[model samples]
Target: MKKKTRTRLLVITACLLLFGLFLRGNPDEIIPFGLVIGGAALIIYGVKNRRQGGQPTVLPIMTKEKEAHYLESGMTEKEIEFFRETMNQTKKQILQLQENINQNAKLKAIDLRHDTLRASKALFKELVKDPQKLHFANHFLYTHLPNMVDLTDKFIEINGHEIKTKETYEKIEESSQIIDQMAALIAKDYQQFVADDLEDLDVELSIAKQSLKRDNSL
Candidate 1:
């Protein structure tokens, strides 16, 4: 057990002692040594399991330095699994870290675009129904469109530049449409981006797995 684990055990032991004392006047039954040890073991076992903590989600996608940062940032097992699924085509667990960052940037852009588009669409609807809403729309678009456009533009650049895959075009195109649909609520294209990002995250992780040709692949 680690120092922390020992400390926790000590704390639990103290609580048990206090409880046992509190019941001093009750049943004069003596506490068995075996029972005491058994209870302590259970406490230690729980502490160990709690300390075991799951492997990181973004660990496979980051550089050593970046991975340290990721762990420090407290990634959950589910998040790491999701991250692995996104950059499935990676060459190695660690190598996937870099790809994860890129995919993350892309996903973040999509999210931002989604929020912006959703707001824009809402404002657009309001503007159409209540002319007074134009001021709000103009305020939002003028204040934020440049940033949104810049992010989408970067997403386009990254996807268009293509790290790999013939389907890259389709992915980027779908993302663009998703962004538009969010802003316009036209034909329900936004779902595709969410679905595709999840799939791609898995796809990328699958690609990184080692075949019979090499070891240490994911």
Candidate 2:
């Protein structure tokens, strides 16, 4: 069973137990007893199933339509699978970073410094459109992005402390600077990744201008 399903069962059990207690003084005591027993049994079953490792995690699988789309884009099955896994991991890291930013005012300020979260999400969207270009984003996907997540996690951890000495303050300041730098670098990564596309647009514009100039001269 999924954790969500298990939690739902536990919640229902709690409600049953509460209702059973409420009905304790009723003329027909059997209903209350039955409810209490059923609730207890559910709790026991949930605990046992959890202890036995409820279920294996299910990985995302590409459907035939998605596979065909990627195939048309010249991606092999292996490359498509790799793209799925890589994007999945990247998305999770981005979500964690967003959550961290929401939790900490400092991180939120850093994100606003250069719109880091939005830039990261934009990068992910671009990759989804042309996953074959994923090779160009190895550093962003594997190193810089992961580093951003880790730094934010540590920053949140240290910032959560009730007491802070001078050294603690210095460490927090240093971490904030580093995170800001990482944010700038992530923005740069997006720019660099799209540089070629920008160049192509420029070339097309130049060609169109030349054609217009010739038409005017004629």
Candidate 3:
């Protein structure tokens, strides 16, 4: 209530009380009754919403541009660039390693030529005693070895960084598929044979020298 309004009401009540003879109702009772009504309403309103001073929750409004700014602040320039470059470099290195493996396979093919020659000679000399066997051996030696050598050699040529024809590519694929195992098996056996031959030749030479020394002593 305003001070002026309250003062006016007090004056009215005071005047009524001073002249109770003219007023039927008691002025003191009226003033106290009005005061009680006002006080009760205030107490009810205060009690109904009495939460203990917690702050109100309010959501902030943000735009996409502001969200992008927040993300950018969390990441540095070098970190982003490094991630991009690392991915690119890793993909490049993977391609290069695949090329390297292809080249290594070609090199392994080329190395088999030595074993092919040895096995071809051995088969012609030892396994072809009969006429029919000889015919078959010759046919295999002529038809198979040359084709294998040519095919694998083409791959070796590619490993040396040259391009080949489609026909040559097909031949390489065919021969490599077949002779992949043959080349390895033959190469190991031929190497062992050569090693044994050299060892025997050394032993014979040593024995021959001993016999010569013995004859000279006689």
Candidate 4:
């Protein structure tokens, strides 16, 4: 068990034990017996679970350092936790999609699909670095990315049939075209998310060039 889990269990056990003891002092109270029994059972179960290498029934524990880092980025603890979970889920989906694309010979042959997947992965990496910008990626995270993965999965499945009819071929072509469109949309999503940064860079570059030209005129 994790230290956090052990600590939580210990605290709960202590509270129960204290309440049980307090009730025990009141000889007329029958609840004290049950409280004590329950507390004891809880401790025993926790210990046994640990001994058996049970998984911790908690979210990933944030270290003080990581919490401080995210705090500096203007994210509350709740937001940080949410971002972490969301990013982890998104990463898994992206990886699975990449694996699917790689395994399918037809998908590998499509240059547009490769480019699209690369763009999506790049955007995901940027989000991982700065989760504060997660708000800007709501559509990408909740809709585009998921839909892209699902469509690609279905496309691959359809393409995998040993026997193919003309209709099947047509459907596969249509799916491929739709996936290409989704890839373009995903690329646009990435550009829009970073549009501010790109604009800022452009402004800075223009300012530098004007300053240099003025200095040369002197």
- Whole-model lDDT values for every prediction: 0.48, 0.87, 0.50, 0.80
Task: Report the Cα RMSD per candidate.
Answer: 24.4, 12.2, 38.5, 11.9
Error of 4 at 172 (Å): 0.7
What TM-score does model 4 achieve against the real structure? Answer: 0.68
Ranking by TM-score: 2, 4, 3, 1
lDDT of 2 by residue, 97-152 (tens): 99999999888888898889998999999998888899999889999999999999
Residue 16 displacement (Å), model 1:
96
User: What lDDT does model 2 reach?
Assistant: 0.87
Q: In model 3, what lDDT does residue 1 have?
A: 71
Clashing pairs in 2: none
lDDT of 1 by residue, 108-139 (tens): 55446555445434434433333322343332
On lDDT, who's better, 3 or 4? 4
- The CA lDDT at 1 in model 1 is 54
Which parts of model 4 have CA positions greater than 4 angstroms off?
Answer: 1-65, 109-114
**For model 4, what is the alpha-carbon lDDT of residue 65?**
86
lDDT of 3 at 6: 52
Candidate 1 lDDT at 104 equals: 51
Predicted candidate 4 versus true structure: per-residue lDDT over 158-178, tens digit per residue: 998999999999999999888
Sort by lDDT, best first.
Answer: 2, 4, 3, 1
lDDT of 3 at 140: 43
